[model samples]
Target: MTEALGTRTITAAVLVIGDEILSGRTKDKNVGHIAERLTEIGVDLREVRVVPDVEEEIVAALNGLRHRYTYVFTTGGIGPTHDDITADSVAKAFGVSIDVDPRARAMLLEYIAEKDLNEARLRMARIPAGADLIVNEVSKAPGFKIGNVIVMAGVPRIMHAMLEAVLPTLDTGPKMLSETILANAKEGDIAGPLREIAERFPGVSIGSYPFLSETGPNTNLVVRSRDPELLAKAAREVADMVAARQPAA
Candidate 1:
């Protein structure tokens, strides 16, 4: 089912595809970068899943995410090697034909000579039918956009570049505003009041992060809301509550 855009609260998901990532051989640096970038643009990244190089897993994950979110960004598995099966898996998910696209081939020719465009190298040019190309600045190999899924390289530098190129074209909503209050009390001590505050402001989201400081147990209460006025109001209430909880000096 196709969803109508132009609505507030745009959401997205990230699908990390690689056997190396699943095995912990390669540390993932793309998810955090993508999450931060999306948050800045008001696109909420709601979910992230790391799948291996298996075709069925990729296809299943892609289908599920694409249907549930506004956009699905996938990283890795679109290279020349045999295990780089993202393109093929995406094609299967979308039920589209996979072939060496002339435009993608042309993009490759700019970097590689015709004589050197071997079958292995040409594998990068195999794009799904009816998908638009995402220009990669760091490398000539282009990522692609099919339906709501945007596929990019797994490398940190290249993924970052492709994300920059693609983000501007995506739909966005009002950026979520946040304010943090330091609760000089333990999370257990503040749970009741925090729950009350959270219940009071259904529009605002309150997150309690507990950490140990030299001073002793402390909790950071983060309040987030799309509306600035609501956010401020909730933050003020939270601050007041925390102040009341603290002992007088």
Candidate 2:
């Protein structure tokens, strides 16, 4: 059944929320991970927003991104901490009631004795009604799915685990194909012709990843496309373009 459906282009947006992120107390790594993962799963990451813990900002960002993209994944602010407000903001965005879900409560109950599961811990159980849970094996506080949005934890390890638990349930498109050519050059020197090739192959995405080392300047030109043939075609053009600019050696 899955094979019958060929690869389809999908666009996605990510929302990273937390005061710590905004204040520069913690640097966010999830955005980079999600972008790569989406690309691997045949989804294009069109937009990313890092918002503070404020509810109004989160709700607005959520409503806008969910409407604009195929899927919206939010990381952070879903933990037991006092500042964890992603769930509440998402509930407001969907105009739903925030309450302790029976399923989530049950899951919490499994790990903690009833006497020990106090209101503070129950905070983790409060999910928007009618949303599916994303399992967190590292810490049993499950993430929730409301509409097209999947809200997960901020901690990298738990967030990755939750993603693993939920990713299988999602309908993924065709994997994107990529070809890379490494050359001894700087990005500025190659940016112009690369842009032209990118324009020529409108169906494919051409990106230049640059690095500096004792070996001298280097750049990896990456060509990505859903079509393998198109990716190869673009890659060849990029290599030719780079070679034309390379000094005699």
Candidate 3:
């Protein structure tokens, strides 16, 4: 999708790299975790895609996302197992050489005994050249960052830790601010008036959400913008619109 004109939108895309996720064997947790962290840091999550553990598929997704967005985050398939092909695919994506980095190996040794450091575990240390490490506090194994693409572990805890480590390094634009007004009227009733309010406020985004309770269907008008003043102005209009449509007590 095209970005709105004249807006400073710092966009990001998430590539979920694993077969188990697509097969429904393992549900995704990192996409939401990463998206939440990115939003807090003022990055807009523009797109999300889940690809199987195929090198070509991973490479294609990475290439497309890294160029299209400000940042590309991949979760899963970075473990020691054979299906953990995220690292290798990332290396091939950038056409860079992949080898066991001394820094990553040192971190792994801090948790693994010398005798237990097998070839499979060593695979976790293989990072692409000229890439920085994303620290994983949960496990000694680290993720890697090359260019705008950040590769993270599939495990939710590990991915969350790595995202926190990467957050401070991002270049953020204006933060998205939101104000919500709960309307006693149903969504169907307020949809027409809400559309008028939205057209009146070009710089602000107005959304209507419906939920059911003991009182039946009700609408929530959410106004989002980077400027607080603009958001406030739009929110007031939405509240007024909802009030006008509400039934008299």
Candidate 4:
């Protein structure tokens, strides 16, 4: 097992594949959830790409993301439907064979009667060779892990459950520490200066989250870093910046 290096950065990318998402039939919530979860476990979400269910597109996206990031997660397109070609595309990307895994078959067998586990349902079991199974607790159908890519369900509930099952097995680096300062400023007003602070704190990730309410305009400046001291220092600087911009009462 490879241990995560100390102070070494780990990053991940998400590939959301489905015609449904691209057509606006379904909104993608997995990317945000996965990003938060990965950040909690010390992996930075570097990029996200939403692609249609085209095989060539899926193959190209997966190949690119898998090589660029420590982990690549793909949600949507692993189902038994006709448009579900994620498995085949992933296999092609790795130059591997797509086959039914006996382990996955056994797990499915536990839920459904032997006679009922027919061809279509068995389609879910067609995992890429040498891939590890990511257990699906809600349904017996399993997600798969090939190399550094994890193929999970499209349904947010199921995808979240599958991630819970898989996260423990991954090597996580030092969890990020974050500090926030809320200021009565618009995002547009602070975006430029905040970006400068972010550049200054090279090790920290600075984000400006703006919210509107009856209370007035508010922006939360969050600074995240693997080093607690660095995060605190950056947070103070951001607070000062925001305070300076606030109109004196």
Candidate 5:
């Protein structure tokens, strides 16, 4: 669901597609990068899903995410191989036809020689109908945007370039403000009061993350709100709770 503060929340989801990722052969590095980049631009990354190279699975996940969120960013399966089926799957998901676009071919020709652009390599030029290309500066193979779904490359560098190229075209909301209070106490120690504080500030989001410190287990209380005043107020209350929970010297 899109989070609401004062303005309408712009939400997005990430769909990671690759057999290698699901089989644990390739570790995902795009989700976190996408999350951070979107957050920086005031877009909330609501959900993330990883699916294999199967077309039906990708189509299902793409349709599901496209209808649910404002935007769906997909990584992988757009390469120059039989398994690179993201473009076709996205076309199927949108009920559109897929074909090699002259525009995409031109982009590829910037790097790949025309004679050397074999059948497999030409696969990179396939794009869904009515979709805009997301330029890939690193590699000439372009990503594409169809409806709300953005199909990007799986390689971290290429994906990063595509995301950068697409970010300017997206709508963003007010940035989410956050403050962290190092509550040098266990999560259990502050759960009760934290709940009370959270209830008091309906607009603020309170999260308690537990970690092991040199002494023992401790909790980090993060207070988040779009409004600076509200964030400061919630942070003060959280700090007070942490101080109260602290042992006297």
Candidate 6:
């Protein structure tokens, strides 16, 4: 669901496809890249799902994400291979026909010669009917955007480029403002105070993240809110809470 503050907040989901990702053979990187970029443009990344190459799984995920969020971004399985079933699965999800888009084929020709575009390589041109192409500056293969679903390549570089091309077409929402306070105390020391602060500021989201460094364990208290004023106030309260617990020196 789209988050609402003062303005309508646009939310999106990243569906990472391919069995390689689940198998640990290929770690998924597009989620973070897409999430950060989308946040910069005021889009909230609501959900992320990684599914295998199974067509049924892809279709089910597509239907769920597309309907749930303002926009759905799917990465992987659009390449030219037998396992690249994202295009066809997406078609079935939307009840549309899949065909070799002339536009996509034309784009591929710019990198691969017409005669050299073999059957496997030519599969890159297959797109769901009535979908627009997302420009791939890194690779000549184009991604497709149909309805609220945007399908892009799995490679981080290529996905990053495609996201850039599609940014202009999206409608963003209110930007989230955040503030971080480094608490010298351990996470356990700050949990009680953090929870109290969270209750005090219902509009602001306060999270306590703990990390172990070479020196010792520390807590990173982060406050986030759509309202900058609220965020600032909550952050100040958090700082005060941390200071109150310190022994007088």
TM-score of each: 0.93, 0.90, 0.94, 0.89, 0.95, 0.96
lDDT of 6: 0.89
The lDDT for every candidate, in the order shown, is 0.93, 0.86, 0.88, 0.87, 0.92, 0.89
| lDDT by residue (tens digit), candidate 1, 198-244 | 99988889999999899898999999888788889999999999989
Model 3 lDDT, residue 35, Cα: 78
Predicted structure 4, TM vs. truth: 0.89
- Give lDDT tens digits, candidate 3, residues 40-138: 878999999999999999999899989999999999998999888899999999999999999999999999998999999999999999999988899
Please provide, for model 2 over 1-249, each residue's C-alpha lDDT reduced to its tens digit, 9 standing for 90 to 100: 122136555678999998888888898988988888777766778899999999999999999999998889999997777888889999999999999988998888878899989888899999998899988888788998888999999899998898878777777777778888985688888888888898888888788899987887889988877777777888999888878887788
lDDT of 6 by residue, 164-213 (tens): 99998899888887889999899998898789889988888888889998
Using TM-score, rank the candidates from best to worst: 6, 5, 3, 1, 2, 4
The positional error of residue 194 in candidate 1, measured at the CA in angstroms, is 1.1
Ranking by lDDT: 1, 5, 6, 3, 4, 2
Off by over 4 Å in 4: 1-6, 187-200, 241-249
RMSD per prediction, one decimal? Answer: 3.0, 3.3, 2.1, 3.3, 1.6, 1.6
